[model samples]
Target: MEYGYYPGCSLIGSAHRLNSTTKKIFKRFGHDLKEIPDWHCCGAFEYGNKNELTDFSKSNLKKAHGFCNDIVAPCPACYKNLKEANQDDGGSFSILHPLDVFEYFDIVESIDIKHDLEGRLFTPYYGCVLLRPKETAIKNKDIMENFITRFGGDVDGEKVKDRCCGGNQFFINRWATEKLSRLIIDNTHGDLVVFCPLCHMALKTFSENRKVIYFNDLLLYVMGETDKL
Candidate 1:
């Protein structure tokens, strides 16, 4: 499968690990992630209302329209933006999460990461999108736990998986974000694992003593393609 990837701002800088690990894992699965050339920020936080006119919003929509293929994203913010971009541009292309792509191959037994999470404790945190009503079809939370199981890792299934970590909003809204992060971190028995780079960053910032990782990072670790940092 091929997808037009959007590596949003954060992944290019603080979240570079997401891009590297994502490319490695997707390539291992025989999926091509072609990036859209000259792509810019999708306005990270929120988009203006329809009546409001702005080049950032228009450019974002236009770039998404130009892709004309399935859009895949590793960042939760990127996923939210890409999908919203398509909607803003009249649903020009199908937007898919990399997790969906991973599930597709796993269900067919086409690709398997050579690793396990058994006996290792970690919490899988899904930002707003995973908990929202729209992603119900992907079976987001349960499937994530299942993926951990595939790698022989003991995922603490009892932890709260859908809490908001405030993400980049942490700097802007420290109190709310910190409160949310503390609730999840304290409730989770050990470290945390996440699909979104922003969530990974937020969790790491929230608790330095605790370990936090991206899902793709775990895949690379199990594949023996890289060593623990």
Candidate 2:
């Protein structure tokens, strides 16, 4: 019923829609998401490059455990990082994505019945770090596909769909990312739908009909039509 919410840096800052829509859906599920007090950024992906993995995990684990054992992260980067921390520290806490929270409560009130993506042709985009550490139980591609299907969307299975979106990689090697992005677009051959902000930003430049959207935005659009919380 209650969990410690971690909005991450992107969602709290650039992704305003994510934070607002998340809170709205939480309320609909009768769940309280109290933000971790004095929370710090999860240091999305690149943090471990500088700091020791164990040390970074310890620092974040302290901040998270101080709040609660049930940690819910809205951003894929944050979710992967927090989950990694919990495992590395040998902590008992369980980290879950916000969508998992929504699904757990069976809260459909926040989504509009008519706005479902039943017949839409959409491709999932998983940026770097979404399913990190390479050993976690969660797979970004699978999770996003499950979430899409729950909301009524057809996932393209013609070929391998669980590939990177060439997002952060673009920052360093534009050529590699361009090649990757082109392959991804060519494979999907339609509009791409994704949850990661970085992925959305990257694909926007290459994909002409780029329809990058936060999964939370879709929920918000549906929620707007429902009775206010």
Candidate 3:
């Protein structure tokens, strides 16, 4: 199976680990992820301006569609923007997150789980961008929880899964971002917190007690490819 891959801006910067691990796991699953040629940023959160956001998103979508109809982004922010752009443009192309692509291909059932996390506790953090507006959000939260369990990690139910991480306000208002991050950390009752790149970044900064990791990192560990990550 093959799909158009959009790394987005974060992948090269804060989310480089996610970029490398996702490619490694995809290949192990017998899937090919050809990067969309000349892809641009997904414009993160739009703030209060829609025109500039639409223009930036549309431009990136145009490049992605030029490569393939199915484009998968690893970052939730990128996925949301790409999905919204595709919908607004009435394009036939499909925009999906890396998790969605994995689910579509049913990669979990075939996983070997070389390194099970049986004794560990994990909190699946959704942050904000991943599940907002309903339409673009990940439809099956259980799939992620099940993935954790399949790899031998116990999903903690006490953690607030859909809390906002204040990623958009991180630069604008440090206080708000820290406040939200604290709320998530305070509520979490796990040894480790697993989530997307943005959430991982925010939560890790404010969290001193628990380890925070991207879900891709955990998946790589399960595949026994942690050395590469």
Reference-based TM-score of each model: 0.84, 0.79, 0.92
What tens-digit string does per-residue lDDT give for candidate 2 at 1-229? 8888888788878777778877877776678898877667777767546355445545766876657779878777778777777777785787887756655554553444646666776666655555554755343346556656777777763353556767778789888778877777777744575667677767776777646666665565445644321
Put down candidate 3 lDDT per residue, 1-229, tens digits, no spaces: 7889988898888889888988888888888899988877777875568777877778887776557778878888888888888889996778878777778777788777778888888888877777787989976666678788887788874447887877667788989989988888887767544547777777888888788877778787787877432
Model 1: per-residue Cα lDDT over 1-229, one tens digit each: 7778877787789889888888888887777888887877767566565334334534755675656477777776667666665666677677777787777666425434455455787677776765564732234456667766677777762556876777757778888888878887877866687887767777787885888888777767777676662
TM-score for predicted model 3 compared with the true structure: 0.92
The CA lDDT of each predicted structure is 0.70, 0.67, 0.78
Query: Residue 158 CA error for candidate 3 (Å)?
Result: 5.0
RMSD (Cα, Å) of model 3? 2.0
Best by TM-score: 3
Report the number of the highest-lDDT candidate. Answer: 3
Model 2, stretches more than 4 Å misplaced?
A: 48-54, 106-112, 132-134, 137-152, 157-160, 222-229
Residue 220 lDDT, candidate 2, scale 0-100:
57
In lDDT terms, how accurate is model 2?
0.67
The true-versus-predicted C-alpha distance at residue 196 of model 3, in Å, is: 2.7
* Superposed Cα deviation of residue 148, candidate 3 (Å): 1.3
Better of 1 and 3 by TM-score: 3
Distance (Å) between predicted and true CA of 73, model 3? 0.7
